[model samples]
Structures are given as C-alpha cells and as structure tokens.
Target: MAPKAQTPSKGSKKAVTKTSKGSTAGKTEKKHKRRRKETYSIYIYKVLKQVHPDTGISSKAMSIMNSFVNDIFERIAAEASRLSHYN
Candidate 1:
C-alpha cells in the first residue's frame, strides 16, 4: 500500500500564503490613501514683497512677477534656439 502525503497546518508563523493583490504591508485597504499635504503659509506674499521691489508685496503681484519671469525665459529660450540653428 502507498503512504499518504502530509500537509502543513495553517495560522502558524511557518505557514505561507499568497500575498493579496495591490495590498502592501500594514495598508489593508485596496485603495492607497494619499497623505494630505500641509497648506503653504500665507507669509509667502510678505516674503516676496520684501525681496521684490515696486507695486506692493501682494500675492497678485507675485503672480504677475511669475508670468513676467516665464515670458523672459521664453524669449531667452527662443534666442538660444536661433543661435543653435545657425550653428
């Protein structure tokens, strides 16, 4: 007569099971929770006003400065492109 094979018991530390899909250690929920980002301090406008000269240090002014910087960068990039094309 042939002998029967033995199976290991479950719920023990030695017991091995397939990992659950999309589930990571300590995070049981199928959906990964995004950590809420802390809001930036309102002092940014005051800081910019201290650093930037002219028409007040309001957030609106800072936005305008950002746009001006973008425009200047675009012009510089265009000139560089032209120079590279000639080269």
Candidate 2:
C-alpha cells in the first residue's frame, strides 16, 4: 500500500526564489550592422536585352557574371587606391 501525501496547511505561506549564475552579466555581445552594397540596376539589364535580342544567357549565368564583374572592379579599385600615393 502507498502512503498518503501530506498537503501544506492553509495557515502557512510558500516562497519561490530564483538565483542568477552570473555568466552573461560580465560579457556583452557586439552587433554589427551590415552596409548596403550597390548592385547593377534593372536599367542595365533592360539595355543588355535590347543590345542582344537572341542572347542565349540564362539568369543564373547573369548572376554569376555580375558577381565576377563586381569582384574584379572591387579588386581593381583597391589596387588603384593602394598605388595612388606611390607616384
């Protein structure tokens, strides 16, 4: 046979307390805001389509080409800035 459980009397009060472990208080997280990058405009795509009516380029190819061109320009600009003060 199981013993009966005891219940607290109505005259007594129960208290609940929570304790912090102090782990996150000393450390602060730094949030970095990303800068919006400039990209090729829709007008350029319209002009490209007008220039080559039957071009067999897919959207995926265009995306790859766009990123490659952007990377090249960024590198060239960096090199130019680095060499600007040399001569």
Candidate 3:
C-alpha cells in the first residue's frame, strides 16, 4: 500500500514551497496589494492641457499618454541614477 501524503491544515501557517532551483520561496510571487501613489508636477499638467488636437482627446487617451510619459521618465531616471554613481 502507498503512503498517504500529509496536507497542511487550515489553521496552520502557510508553508513555504521549494522551487525546482531548490531555493526557499514563500509568497514572493504574490503582487503587492497596495499601489504606489502617482503625482505629477504642475508643469506637466500645463503642457498636457496646452497640446490641442483637431478633436479633443478623450480621458482614456489622456490616461494612456500619461502612462507612456511616466514610463519614459522612469527609464530616464534609472539611467541618470546609474550614471550618477560613476565619476
């Protein structure tokens, strides 16, 4: 007869599972429940307001553009941080 596998009970603390790499892993794969706050400078709002299209952009379009702009800034900031450490 085959031995039955042991299962953790509901009250027990979540057990850490090992990966194929044999590294100790827990809930690292879980995403953070909280989102970071996003803030924009007044100048950014001013420029976004000033840019006119033949027809005004919808809120959704504006949001997409804002994300793209923020991503560009993040990439630039990362590069700056890397270079700043160098002489």
Candidate 4:
C-alpha cells in the first residue's frame, strides 16, 4: 500500500518570504570590464621588415601608415555594424 500524503491543517498558515531588489539573495548584475586590444602597427612593421630587410620607414611615414590602417579598420567596422543592424 502507498503512504498517504500529509496536507497542511486549516488552522496553520504558510509564510511566504519575498526578497527585495537590493537584497543579496536576489541575482546580482555584474559589470564586466572591456579588454584592451593591441595595435596592429607593430605586426605591420614586422611584416615589412621581413619582406625587405634593407627597407626602413621614417617615424613620420610610420605614423601616416598607422593612421591609414586605423581609418580603414574604422570604415570596415562601421560597414559591418550597419550590415548587422540591417540584417
């Protein structure tokens, strides 16, 4: 034979506890820090050196190259964002 299930008596009341938003018992939202990305200029310079060991770039020229690469990256990122937003 199966055991009979026990029910709460009519005279007894169950207590219901609610946690507030500020309570630690509730889920906490954590703010994650974004990681810093390394610049591509160093790798670009390395590749250039490998391709031509005798070739050298002036600081001003390197700065121009870095800015050009950054500009292209920004444009590509913007286009990707637009495409993703539309899709």
Candidate achieving the largest TM-score: 4
Candidate 1 lDDT tens digits, 1-87 = 223222234443244434543345447655567998432324545565578846455567666666676678789999999999997
Q: What lDDT is reached at residue 8 by model 2?
A: 38
Where is model 1 poorest over a 10-residue stretch in terms of lDDT?
Answer: 1-10
Query: Candidate 3 at 9: error in angstroms?
Result: 54
lDDT comparing candidate 4 with the true structure: 0.72
lDDT of each: 0.58, 0.62, 0.60, 0.72
How do the residues 62-83 of candidate 4 rate in per-residue lDDT, one tens digit apiece?
8888888999999999999999
* Candidate 3 residue runs with Cα over 4 Å from true position: 1-45, 48-54
Off by over 4 Å in 1: 1-56
Clashing pairs in 1: none
Clashing pairs in 4: none
**Local error of candidate 3 at residue 57 (angstroms):** 1.2
Preferred candidate (TM-score higher): 1 or 3:
3
Residue 37, candidate 4: alpha-carbon lDDT: 72
